[model samples]
Each structure stands twice: as structure tokens, then as C-alpha cells.
Target: MQIELLVFIVMLGAFLLGNFLLKLPVSISMIMGAVLGALVAGEGFPLRHLFEGTFVYIDTILIISTAMIFMKVIEKSGAMEALNVTIVKRFHKIPAVMLIMLMLMIMFPGMITGSSTAAVLSAGSIVAPVLLLMGIPAPQTGAILAIGSIMGMAAPPVNIPAMLIAGGVDMPYIGFEGPLLFLTIPGAIFTVLFIGMRYCKNLNYDEIIKNLNFNMNAKHGFKLYLPILTVLTLMVLTRVLPTAIPNLGMPLIFMLGSIVGMFTGEKLDFISTVKDAMNTTVPVLGKLMGVGMFIQIMTLTGVRGYIVISCLGLSTVLLYVAIATVMPAFGAVSSYGAASVLGVPFLLALLSGNQIIVAAALSFICSLGDLMPPTALAGNYAAQIVNERYFKVLRYCLIPFTACIIFGIICLIYSKNLSFLV
Candidate 1:
């Protein structure tokens, strides 16, 4: 028991230190801590083998890293830039229509890329300029981009969090598609409408549209768009098509996209693109590796089991609140971590018929981490593109964030008797 506690403390401390002080990615910190914990618990303290086992979550990590590489290659090829500029130009005639169309455009890259950062960086570079040229405040532009990116995460294919959880739960790879389409899509649409309508209500739509810059070099040949379009089509097909078609998984498709992107243009250089993609891929993969290690260490140390037992002791209502609140905190730090720690147990609890309400409640609350301050990765990316403070951007996001949480809670309450739907 003492050794287990020590392992937990050391691992947790290392994770925090790496994240906050050393400025290292959380995954690296987690790996270091896990290694240390395993040594300490297995030898010195002699607790039930801290590394009771290892699961090759590294495969998932590789898949994600390759996806990032694919996105980086596409971004470097200027395909994303072209897509953004094209969308803006095509919709310049109507500001409201432009906003809606831009929302969809952003969603496309975001869903395929799996990195909200990439999505915002690519989309915002174009959208922010248009928003600014139209006399929109930086804060407002930041808000729009941040909120739109959040909505995009709820879309198909590249939703990493949803994918992780669904995979962990052994549901169909795309099982959440139906629920997300039914729930998050409508929720996102309304959220966009409400926010966009509120922001643009006072603006002169004609004037905004007239002043927009419709011409730019952010154009690409049809070939560059093909890979992205193909990927998007596959994603949609995965949702609707039969499972036996040997559907290309998202990671491989992305890798193929990168290859296609490299040859699509006169300026495109395959070697440089591959190298550039690797530069981005390495760090991302390292971090993911570290996260997997951390999760493994936690499992070995029995801390995760302790957490589960503790939660199980609580009444269903209290458990719901506790999990709803705590999961968001972990998610705020790392969505992957949240999925591993909170998501796994939440799923287990639900399967066991204990804290089922809380388990369901977490599906929504966990998303808040993506929008919260400090580590609000998605929001920060948006802010970076528009040159605004991450927290300031987060402030504007609170409205939609709150709405998602409230809706999730309502779902939890109602889902108690609707297990079939869940």
C-alpha cells in the first residue's frame, strides 16, 4: 500500500512537473514517471508488480501520429490554404451564408486532420483575414474560429476522443456516429446559428460582403483536393457502408493522402514533404507514447482501480456529479488522458450497472476540456491564429460549452431508462 501510494505520487508529480515546469509534452512526462514508478514499485517497495502488464496502445499512438503527419504534409502543400481561401471567395457575396459555409469548410479539414490545431491554423489563416477585413474584432474572430473548431470535432472520422472511447468500449469503430450525428450535430448547428446570428445581428451584411477580399493565391489544382475529398468520402462511407468492404482505415487513408499531395503540384517535392511530415510526426508520436506509458503505469500501480472503487462507493447521483466534474479536469489537461483514465472506468462502471448515469454524463462533460483554459488545446490554437489570448477566447466559448454540458446532463437523466438507445 505504501509503495503503491509512492508510485502514484511520483508518477502524478512527474506528469505535472513535465507539463507545467519543464514545458515538455505531457506524454513524455508520463512515460518517464511510469518507468520510475515501475522500478520503484517492483523493486524497492515491492508492491504487486506495478507493471502488471503492458498493452500495445502504441499502435493507436502510431495511427494518430501518422494522421498528424498526413495533415502536416497536406498543410505544407498549400492544399489546406487553398481550401480555406476558396471557401471564403465562393461565399463572399453573403456574410451570413459565408459564415455558415466557412463553418462547414472548417469542419471538413478538422474532421479529417484530427488536430484541432491544424484545422484552426489552416482555416483561421484565411478566415481571420476575411473577418478582420470585414471589420470584425480579433476577439470575435477568435471566438468564431474556436467555437467552430469545437463543432468540427463532433463531426465524423477524425474525432480522436470519441474514437478512443468507442474503441475502448469495444463498440463499432464508428458506433458513436449515429449518436453524435443525432445529438452533437443538431446541438452544434444551433450553437453556431445562435452565436453567428448574435454576432452578425448588428453588422451590415452587404457592407461586410462587399469589403471582403475575394482574390488570393490560396488556390490549388483539382488534384490537391482529390485526396482530401477521397478521405472525406471514405469517412462518410464508413458510416453508411457495410463493414465487410475492407474499408481503408483513417490512418492509412491519411498516409495515402500525404503521398498523393506530394505529387499533385509543380512545386510539390515528395522527399521534403516526407521529411517535414516526419518532423511533426515524431514529437506527436513521442507524446502519445508517453501518454500510453502513463496509462499503463497507472493501471499497474492500481491507482486506476482505486479510483474506480472509490467512485463505485458513491451514490449514483453523487457519482454522476463527481465524475462529470473530475473528468473535465483531466480532459482539460489531456483529452487522451481523460479518455484513458476517466473514460475507461466510466465505461466499466456503466457496464457493471454502477454509476451508469455518471458514465453517460461524461460523454458530454469530457468535451469541456477541449474548450477550457490553460490547456484548452483547440481554443488556444484558434487564439494563436487570430492573435488573441487563449483564456479570452475561452470566455466566449463558455456559452456553447455550458450548453453542451447541460444537454449532456439532461441526456444522462433521461438515459437511465433508455439503455437501448445508449
Candidate 2:
């Protein structure tokens, strides 16, 4: 076998051994893989390359760090809770609408942080009891949360996997909002409607209201929502009036929003909240760093080029099948890992299509890795919130999971037709 292929196998094997056998953090496993791959390729320690790889995603890391802090701010300041309560109060009369809205609420954090764990832990916790109060079973509630969180992780503004894939190919992380929204919004709506709509048809508004803590909305009213609005408005203005309004990058936007959150709703210890947010964000950041190292080594050893060249030989149908299966299956390790290792190659193989649309679709599929077994970050946490086994949540997610794969493949196949989105 070629040295590049051997190095690739060594890296992948090492990652699996470390992650499944040794039970290392996915980030560390990836780092182990990178180290092993470098040794196999006779690259010595390659410390300089490894360190360079860590900085490959520095911009994305900044976005995630600031966005997590922003998420923590809204969550701690009661802005998130207030919004949940307000959604329930306004839409309780319409179960379908309410379920969709709640799913969106569950998606909000992941949308910002590009980490499904954040959404599952923060918004999923807030929405779980409400779904239970609506008579949705624990398993189905967990499924809804899991699916919504993954979809959120794939959404616009901060989709790390998409960003990684784009970065891998040296593509700009721009013009993705349209394709991402197209994929995730409908996917999120379908998950909630399919999993929770039947149970939520007759929601108990009085009971839900009694259980919901809406003190922020009650005390602060419209002002409680200002931070969220500021972030949204700034994101839009930067896009809409790029020439007039300086395009504050996502990191700055999130930081500005976080600062606004400090004073908008509840009083919070800025230092403590920032520390907590950073603490929660470190693992994900590590994963990004590891993926960077892994991919950097892959590139240095010619493994990345080998994979792309190998993918170029596949039939379109086989390529689709690979994406539908291999990407998510590998995601069982780490979605970021799957994106950097597989997603980048797949994107290159499909370069005949609209690059932006194809990258967006590929990222959507990679995001589903968060639902894969053993290390189902979103699924595990979502199940915990609903007091259900992760497998039970996976069982409920089978249909939506399959649907997302089919939808993503369709997006890939028709990417050229969808170029208008870019």
C-alpha cells in the first residue's frame, strides 16, 4: 500500500483505539492519531506543523468561545428562560406552532456556539419539562431535543463543521447562511412535528405556565429580549449593509451581545460567568485543535490528497452512499473530526457542484454525527435531561436521522440547481 494510505490508516486506527478502547477525550484521541500518523510518515515529532494546525481554526475557536459566553450570558441572565416562557404563553393555543417554536428555542444555543452539547444542556433542559407537560414521552422528548440540537449545530452564523470543511479547502466561510437555513429550519421543524406534535396537540398551558419560571419577562418585559435582538440585528445589518455598517465579525458580535446580556436582565458576576463559559467551551475547543493537528498532519503526509484522489474515483451514487453512512458513522468519534478528515475530501470530490451549497449540505450531514452512538454528545445529554436512555432517544431519532441523511444527499445531488442560494 502507498505510504499516504498507510499513514491514514494508522491515524484512524490510533484515533479509534484511543477513543473507544482507551476512552480518551475525542480531542486527545485525535491528537494521538495525529502524532501516530506523523511517526508513520517519518515526520519526526513535527511539532511546528502540529502547532500550526492548532492555529488553523483560531478564528473559529474565537467565534465558539465568544458565542458560548454569549449563550451562557443569555442563559444565566434569564433571557433564554424568559423567551421560552413567552413562546409557550403566546403559542400554547397552537400545538404544532408551539412545538416548532420550542424546537427553535432548543436550537438557539447550538446555532450560536456550533456545539450541540451547549444546546442540549442549556435549551434542552429548559424545554424538556415543557414537552413532558405536553404529554410527550421521555424518549420522544429526548429525540426532539437531540435532533433539534444537531440541526442547530448545522445552522448559520457559527457552523463549525462547515467552517472546518471550508477552511480545509481554503474556502471562505461566507454565503453559507442561505443553504444552511434551507437544510436546518425544515429539518428542525420536522423533528418537532414528528416527535412531539402528536403529544403536544393538547398542551396543558396552565400547568406549563405554573411550572415555567418567567420572572425575567415579567419583571423586565421587552428589555429582557434586547440582547438577543441586538445580536440578531447586528448580524443582519452586517450582512445587509456591509458597505454602510462595518461587518463586526462573529466573535465581536457575540462579545458585544454578551456584554449587553450582563446588564439587560438579571445581575450576574461577569467574571464568574465568563469563567464558566470558558470552562464549558474548552473540550470543544480542544476537539477543534485536535482536528486541526490531525488534518495538518494528513496534509503534510499527503493523506489528505490521497483521500481526495480516491474519492474522485467513486461513482456519484457511491459517493452519496458514503456520505450518508460513513460521515455520520465516523461522527461517533467527533463531528469535527469527521468534517476535517472525511468532509473535506467529500467536498473536493463534489467540486463539480456548487461549492457553497455542497459544503453546506456536507456540514449538515456531519452535524448528525452528534447523534451517533457511544459519544452521542447531543443525544446523551438530551436523554439525560428527559430521564431516558440514550438508545431510547436514538430509537426515536431513527426516522428523523434517516430523513436528514436523505435530505442532505438530495441537497448534494442537486447542488448545482441550488446554487441560487449562494
Clashes (N, CA, C under 3 Å) per candidate: 0, 0
> Which lDDT tens digits does candidate 2 get at residues 1-422?
99998999999999999999999998899999999999989999999999999999999999999999999998998988888898889999999988889999999999999999999999999988889998999999999999999999999888999998998888999999999999999999988998877776666788888898867887888877888999999999999999999988999999999999988888999899999999999999999899899989999999999989998899988988999999999889889888888898899898899999999999999999999888999999998998888998899999999999999999999999998988
The residue ranges of model 1 lying beyond 4 angstroms of the native Cα positions read 1-6, 43-55, 76-78, 89-94, 167-172, 201-224, 236-244, 263-266, 352-364, 415-422
Clashes of 2: 0
- lDDT (CA) per prediction: 0.63, 0.92
Where in model 2 is the C-alpha error above 4 Å? none
Question: lDDT score of model 2?
Answer: 0.92
Give per-residue CA lDDT, model 1, range 1-422, as digits (tens).
55667777887777778778898776667766777777776734322332322233555555566666667667766666666666656665565676677676666555655555656766656667766665566776777777666666555555555655665556554344444544456555655565665555454545545654333242445776776776666666765685745667667777776777676643666677667656755654565556666766676667777666766677778866766577777765676667666776666655644233334345445655677656777788888887888777777677777677677667655654545443
Q: How many Å off is the CA of 118 in candidate 2? A: 0.7
> Relative to the unseen true structure, what is the Cα RMSD of model 1?
4.2
| Model 2: lDDT of residue 214 | 69
**TM-scores for all predictions:** 0.82, 0.98
Error of 2 at 132 (Å): 0.7
